[model samples]
Target: MQYAQLGRTGATVSRLVLGTMNFGPHTSEEDSFAIMDRALEQGVTFVDTANVYGGKDHRGRTEEIVGRWLARTGKRDEIVLATKVFGEMGPGKNDRGLSALNIRRAVDASLRRLQTDHIDLYQMHHVDRSAPWEEIWQAMDLLVAQGKISYVGSSNFAGWHIAQANETASRRGSLRLVSEQSLYNLLSRSIELEVLPAAEHYGLGVIPWSPLSGGKLGGRREDGVRRRAADRRHDPADLTEQLERWETFCEERDLTPGQAALAWLLHRPGVLGPIIGPRTMEQLDSAIEAVDIVLSEEDLAALDEIFPGPGGPAPEAYAW
Candidate 1:
């Protein structure tokens, strides 16, 4: 497991983050435990989860699973644990959003479920449009002062949101957001339009989730069958052609499409690796192996031709 500083922070984290989204809903508790054990054993030290990952009825199930694993393994000190807030965790209106009240309640609930005193990184699951930056930062600043969380991050935020956030944090003398978890992959390049650039400019590490675009790039089976199309809604001719070209390129290079997908993110600038949410040990190993599959400049260019981004970034990507 290669290590890099999480954004500009001195605290180092594994390049390949072990996302635990599948722990409660998709994977059984026993399997989840085994996979986590294997992850730490292999040096995948950064783990990410959320308060609403356990499906509708079991909102905090994933955290409880992770907490139990921590207690059993006694490896709390060895791992960098991150989780999020700002979701409809209950029927009450206050049960959601980034209000200071909710933030306070949410962190304590997450800490209890996680069975840990302090979270390595606490992220906003989504931007709360209603919550003022001062209110949000005030709550977060209090948490930091109390040693409830070490750092703050964001997910599913746009470029300007990142700018507005850190600019506010800077004024308040806060460490601000150190990372941004966005949906990024070979197939999903929209983030390049603005999100990626903002994170880079703000000195926030980009941790890409859904790095395989929900298994669209999970690689074809040995029998040459696609588990699912990249996008079923509008499978345009161009997208079909791109998929064909991508498959052929991977075949010629003796690489699984999944590996190509992950390796592509690893090659990207400002990327702090990607979130690999493996449901099984084999899946975990495959993702770990992808970390070593280095893509050359030519290979990257070919991939760009297949899944071309928003051209480049901002005005240049559009106007010029």
Candidate 2:
């Protein structure tokens, strides 16, 4: 459990963040508690969750499960608990988005469900295009002043959105986004086109979510093909060919595809860490292996050749 600064902030966090998205829907509460216990035992102090996580019908169940774990273990101060906003957690018009009202209402609800007085990191689950930055920052500022949250972050945001957010926060003399949670994996490198660059420029730690591409790179080659097929983004035949090449490379290096994939993210520049939402204790233990698995120059180059990202950052990615 190597530790590093969370972006430019003075605070430190573990390289392997424990994500609790699967706590309620896929995993039983007992298993969830056990998994978290194991992670904490192994020094995974950074735990992430969201208020809207528990499957469609049970939006707050995941947080409730986490709250119970915190209460039962009495480790609230030991863990850096993070969660998200900007999701529909209710049926009202003011239930979602980054409006001041929603952000205020959302944080209180999250605190209750998480059973924590303050969120270590509160993130915007998605970009709320309609919400003005002034309004959003105002709400966030209030929380900070009230001691409801320590830091703010963003997830699933475009490169431009990252720029927009920080620029606004800067104007308000606020400590802008300290970290970014984006979809980045061997199968999806779209963020490399701009998001990574923006985060680096703004000094936000890059935390890659779904680092396995929803199990595509988790030694389960078929998941990649099946998921891609549903979106019709790539021909199934081409995707299979790619996955076979990837598997062969992993085998030659005596690595599970999961290990190699995680190691790749660990090696990426500006990446603080990748989020690991393990459904079982074994999965959590397996992910921990990559934290120590060093990928050399050759290994990284080979991975890039196998899963070439969006060319590079734009406008170079698109032009000269």
Candidate 3:
């Protein structure tokens, strides 16, 4: 577990961040605890979750499970905790977006649920178009001033949106987002065309989610099950062409699709870190092994030929 700076904020985080999307729904509390323990034991000091991952219909279940683990292990200080907001959490419209009111409300709820007073890296789950950039950045800045969160970031945002927010923060002289999280993988290299360059140019760290392209790279699809629908890969509509190209590339590289996929991103320059969402120790090990499976120039060329960048039609809005 190598460590890297969290953008320009001077905070260091583990190279591999443990994502807890399964903590609430498909995974049980005991399983969640075991996963967290194993990740920590393996030196993964960065954990990412969200207020919406808890139980079905009951938001914040994942945080509750993490809170219990923290209390039991007394390891809150040992990890760099990251979580997100902006998904629909309830019936009311107020439950969503980056509005100052909701940011305040959500942070308090997140703190209570996670059993922590301050978050390490707070993030906007997605770019909420309804709110102006200043309003959102100002609200996050307030949280920083109040000592509720150490740093701030964004997820599923376009390069332009992040630039706008950072410019807004500059004008206000507040803390701007230091990191940007988006989807990146062998099958989904679209970010390389814009988002990645923007992050590098602005000195913003890049932490991509689903580096495995859901389960497609993992090599364990059940019979009759869709390769992506079950695991939420790039929008099904946009994946056909990319997945086909990936399948061909895997054969030529003599790499399990997963290894090739992860290895490609592991070596991409300017990536602060890539979030690995493994459900078990085996899956986790495979992900870690990818860090060392260096790809040759030829291998990369093959991939570039398949998932060519912004020149092609854009992937769907829901691909994230």
Candidate 4:
């Protein structure tokens, strides 16, 4: 697998990141371990998880399983471990958000669960509008000084949120956010309007989540499987037509829909890598192969004709 520098940081990461959202929820412990083993063998060393993963009843079970794998294989140093905070982990009111108190408690909990002394990247799972950036960055800065987390990142944040947070860090001379994890796929290109540009302008690595649109672009509709629910902002019939055209386009290029979809994200500007959350070994293997499927200019034009993004970006996509 090819490795690229994560944003402006000196550290490099795999082109494909292994997401562990399904670790203990949809996949069993044995299967998760096998999938991770295969991933390392295939050279995918960037792994992402969250403190609120696992399942409804098994909140931290996923991290526990990953911790076990790390302990058994002694591969902790071989992987770039990433996890998220700002999610409710217990019954207390302070169990969530970016408040300094919650951040302090959350990092310790995550470290204990993952069986690691430091997290390579600790991200805010979502923007806490109520918490001031001063408190947030101060907490993260403390973690950095304590060698608890090396880098900070954000997930599911709006464009302005990235700017505001980074600006605050800049003023404070604290470590700014180095990466962003956003939902961007063949069916969901809304991030192009502002998020992608903000990330590029700030020199942040864009790690796209759900690059397959939750199986909508996986080519299952030909077998009569319905499209994963419509986005409400779009017409169902229009989306169905788009998917049909996309599937045909992939077939014409001799690519699986999943591969074509992933390749599109791989070639997008400002994208570091797309997170591949595979439940089984086969899925994992298929996702890794997408890195080699290069899309031509004509192929990208055809894709645009099928599922167009927000024209270009911001005002240029709308006004002058």
Candidate 5:
């Protein structure tokens, strides 16, 4: 697999990151282990997980499963492990958020669950409006000094949130965020408005999650099929048309819809890689194939015509 520098950091990661959100709840431990083994075999060194994965009752279960795989194969040093915080992990209100106390407790809990001494990337699952940047950065700086986490990242943060957080870090002369993870896919291009530009300007790698739009772009759903039941909600006719065009585009190139979607993200500016959350070994193998499917300029233009983004970043997309 091709590798790229994660933002301005010295570390290089695989072009495709393996996501473990389905572990325990949707996939069994044996299958999760097999999928992870296949990922490493296919040269995927980046694996991402969150503390609140595996459903409410099974929170931290996915990390435990991953930890077992790491122990069984003794490949802890071979992978760049990433995990997130800022979810309700306990019965109390203090169990979540970016408060220094919660961060301290959460990191230790995540480390224990993952069976690792240090996390390669520790990401905030979402922005904590109540917690100031000072508290957040101070906790993160302590973690860095203690060798607990090498780099910091954010997930589901807006453009201004990234700017504010990084500006705080810059003023403190501490390590700034090296990456931003957001929901970006062929059907969902909202991040193209401001988030992508902010990440690019700040030298942060953009790791896109939900790159397939929850199986809508995975080629399993029939073209022109309504996403929701008519009784539940009205499906947009334009979305169905877009999906039809997307399917035709993929078929013309002899590529699966999922593969084309991933290739699209890989070619987008400021994108380090797209997170692929595969439940089975077959899905894992299919996602890895996207690394080799390069799209030409004409193909990219066709895709733009199918699912247009915000036109371009920010005011240029709107004004002068």
Candidate 6:
């Protein structure tokens, strides 16, 4: 796998990041371990997980699983470990958000669960509109000072909000976001209008989630769509209706919907990497193959012609 620098951070990461959202709950533990092992063997050294994934009851099972695997494998120094915070952990009101107190509490919990002292990249899962940027950055700064987190990032944040946070960090000389994790796929292009440009402008590495459009682009039935009608994981109500036009466009281009979709995003200039979560080794193999497939200018033009803006008749926010 090709490696690139993670934004302005000195650390380098593989072009593909192995996401563990399905590790604990949806996927069996055995399958998770096999996937982890295969990814490492295949040279994918960047592994990302969140605190909320592992188990329905225990939480942090995904990280714990990684910790155990790393311990047994004795390859802790071989991979770049990245994880997130800000999702609600339990019933308590303070169990979530990016406030200083909650950030402190959350980092300690994450460290214990991951079986590691320093996180390579610690990210805010989403913007906490309730908290000031100062509060969030201060908490992140403390983690850096304590050697708990090496670098910080943001996810699910708007361009304006990220700009504000960058400004705050620049003035205060705190650790700024070195990267961003957000949804970007063939079927979803909303980030291109705002987030992508912002990341490019600020020199932030853009780690796009759902490069396959959550399996929809891969010509698979999106299971998440069946689970939640309004699920952004697969079919956003407005965007799904637009899929007909998109699929037709892909067909005319002589490309499978999945290939066409991933190719378009991969060709975009600022994209640093894509997070692809495949349940089976076969699915994983197919997605990794996308790295080798190149799209022509005509193919890209054809896709751009399908939905030039926010996609279909949907408002931009309807996607995320």
Superior candidate under lDDT, 1 versus 3:
1
**Candidate 6: C-alpha lDDT:** 0.79
Please provide, for model 4 over 252-302, each residue's C-alpha lDDT reduced to its tens digit, 9 standing for 90 to 100: 889999888889999999999999999999899999999999999999999
lDDT of 1: 0.92
- Candidate 3's TM-score: 0.88
TM-score for candidate 1, residues paired by index: 0.97
lDDT of 2 at 46: 96
lDDT of 4 at 15: 89
Please give the CA lDDT of all the candidate structures. 0.92, 0.90, 0.81, 0.92, 0.91, 0.79
Candidate 1 colliding pairs: none
> Which is the winner by lDDT between candidate 3 and candidate 5?
5
Count the clashes in each prediction: 0, 0, 2, 0, 0, 2
- Per-residue alpha-carbon lDDT of model 3 for 1-320, expressed as tens digits? 67888898777888888898887687778988898898898788999999888666878888898989998999999999999999778888799889999999999999999999999999999988889987888899899999999988899988888889888888998768889999987667778766887787778889988877767665535484436546654566776666766776776667777767767776778787788876676777766666667788887777777766454323333353
Question: Candidate 1: where is the Cα deviation over 4 Å?
Answer: 229-238
Q: Which stretches of candidate 2 lie over 4 Å from their true place?
A: 221-237
Model 4 regions more than 4 Å off:
221-237
Off by over 4 Å in 5: 221-238
How many Å off is the CA of 316 in candidate 5?
A: 1.2
For residues 167-191, could you state the per-residue lDDT of candidate 2 as single tens digits?
Answer: 9999999999999999888888989
Tens-place lDDT per residue, model 1, 121-229, is 9999999999999999999999999999999999999999999999999999999999999988887888998998899998999999988877777766779776574
Better of 1 and 2 by TM-score: 1
Question: After TM-score superposition, what is the CA distance of residue 172 in candidate 5 from its true location, in Å?
Answer: 0.7
| Candidate 5 RMSD to the correct structure | 2.4
Looking at candidate 5, the ten consecutive residues that score lowest on lDDT are 226-235
